[model samples]
Target: MREHNRTIAHPGTREEQMANQQGNQAQGATKKRRTFLGYLALMGPAFVVGAWQFGPGNLTTAVQAGSRFDYTLVWVIAVSTILMIFFTDMSVRLGISTPTSLITSIKGHLGKWIGVLAGFGVFGITLMFSVGNAVGSGLGLSLIFGGSPVLWTVVCTAAVGFVLAFRNVYGIVEKALLVIVVLMGLAFIASTVVAQPDWYRAMSGMVPSLPPGSEILIVALVGTNFSINAAFYTSYGVKEHRRTRSDYRDITLVDTIPGIVAPGIMTVLVIMVAAAVLGKTGAEAGTIGALASVFTPLAGPTGAMVFALGLSGAAFSSMIANATAGGTMISDALGRGAKAGSPTARIFTGVILAFGLAVTLTFQASPVGLIVIAQSLTVLIAPLLGVLIVIMANKTSLMGDLRNKWWQNLFGAIGLIAIIASSIRLITTLLG
Candidate 1:
């Protein structure tokens, strides 16, 4: 038999039209996926900073703010987050502009001592953070597993040390922290949903009240939420990822704003939840256990578990970022190296971990106090870092087109004043 002619649909035929629509849909889907992945690729450095900021210390202050003052302190988180985005954006620009790490660039533009001092200052702040991280990691695990907080602290520290001991440390740290931040966000959001916080009152909390006797808690909240040191570290992350000036805008949109805001929103949610569940009954969440317990009556065991998970995730992620940042900065300060995988950086990181463990073990009786104190102490050193970032970001020689605009400088100055005022308040509170 002869070959038969094959049937074909005309261009305007139903079959042909359906195929065209399907092709267009497939192309659209593919483009959307690629765009999302592009954003994901830019997500590392900022999320790591967010994880570091939202650690146990942040959780503690937010809990206290909610339990003690209800949502009246939510404005602190909101303001701090906005200021944080400005500082982080500056750092991102610096990262794209500088030829070396942030500290190294400081050494180049400022004095050597200033660079070393910035590094040491950051290291000192991280040391304070480590204490809270150690206590928090253990306490969170204990709340979930019914074990000694000290034991879990040890386990968490060791695990973090092992993770940091490897090569490509920044890459590992960035990816791990991104995952942790997402999980922490979900847990807090879920807990908030269960708590059914008072929406009207919570909104009113955004009106900015001092609420007599809220000084220390407010200081701690700003310390953990604004976190100039964390913002300072963002430049290092940008350098590590080899980002360029062209990538700056995208980084701010995808990474910096969301990364910083994630923790801030979570903090606000925590405050709202605590106000609803704990403040109403005048129950104080003085410890992680206490915080978790507040959730139990409102949503039962599941609620407590969710809060615990968020706490544990925050602690663990902060533990990693805190140690890594301390190690890297100190290493850069000492002229050893800027890479987290460097031998000197790793050594310093291990020392930070050990220091936190030692301090936690020594002061096992008053973890909540230690966390608040540690967090507040961070505010004292933050003014210097904030000033340094502002000065560096304004240098036209370095930042070129990416230098701080008038708006950035405006907010940067505001943030600096806020941090300095917090420092002064903390000093007076401690002395009194």
Candidate 2:
């Protein structure tokens, strides 16, 4: 009886220990998952900013660069993406440090006129890029299903308008952009794998070299990837998410990593696929359709389908975000709320989309020409915006302990230099 009682007691003890151990492990896993999800939540705004910047213009530029110069221009994409990280980080910091939107901060620091002018500049830039978004969305639809670009353009414009018309625009926009970003990531990864690019050449391409007549393509790449509007829009996004300076600034900065890296990876993959499939064959991607066709020969029907899907996702995602940026900035500039769901904001967004659709449909402008013009405009505007952000960020009164660090200022200066150089080159190209 004694032995039986001892055996039972010992077994119960071991069972309780096992159960406790299992409970601890489970708790740890749950905690980890929660932490991961928290980080992902923080990533929402950065992802949208990235998606907005990566749009159809970026796709066209990458395709052209790869098809034209093989992997030789990959270094430009790399450098530009790195610069974006710095700019975006500064924007994020600025957003968190202040209680209001970026335009609002500019208004307080400068004057109402400067703020209004900045708003108009951003609005114009967004409108210019919206043309590409319209073209891209239309092209994507046309590629997938037989239809007129005009019909699809109108349809896409209406669809974006419908989405923006909603009262809870920010939430819907963020979630939609996240979905599109995921789709883009998967489609591009699949396409890149199928292309089987020359690894040796691709690696070497990371070394910077300006092949003759590559200046325009280089500037286009930088302009699209390192978008000034994206940096400006970051503050609104952070505001929409309600992140404040009291939060973990370091973690907030880290959350932008996926957003920044995803676009760069997508660009690189597009370049590689183009280099592998079109570069050798000497194919020209003067239009989005031409770019899509390159995937067919390399990866067959399925690859082409995937590329079209990714392009559409990118185009549509960017269209929504670009319009939102335009509306949000203008509305904020006018002292209407910056929240995307506000009626004033939606109206402005509609106006920008309407203008873009009208221009795209009426003029039937060359998509490539539109992209170049938009990029040049961005080059002209980015320096002023960059200077504004740097100055605002360095203000001790505004940023307090969270002001720009030595390293942040250093990178910001470098980015400014790069932007100025690109602007000069673009101006020279247009003039001469």
TM-score of each: 0.89, 0.89
Candidate 1 lDDT tens digits, 1-432: 122222232213334324533443344443233377787798889898999988887887888888889889999999999999999989987877676788987886688999999999899888878988998899899889888999999999999988998899999999889888889999999998998889999999989999999987888888889989999999989888877655666788899989999999999998998888874556777656787897777778888999999999999999999999999999999999998989999999999999999998898887566655665557556888999999988876566566788988999889998999989888787778
Per-residue C-alpha lDDT of model 2 across residues 182-289, encoded as one tens digit per residue? 999999888888878898999999999999989888888888898877877888887787665444353455567778889888999899888887655567665567
lDDT of each: 0.85, 0.81
Off by over 4 Å in 1: 1-34, 279-282, 367-377
Ten residues in a row with the worst lDDT in model 2?
25-34
Model 2 residue pairs with clashes: none
| TM-score of model 2 vs. true structure | 0.89
Model 1 pairs whose backbones collide: none
lDDT of 2 at 96: 68
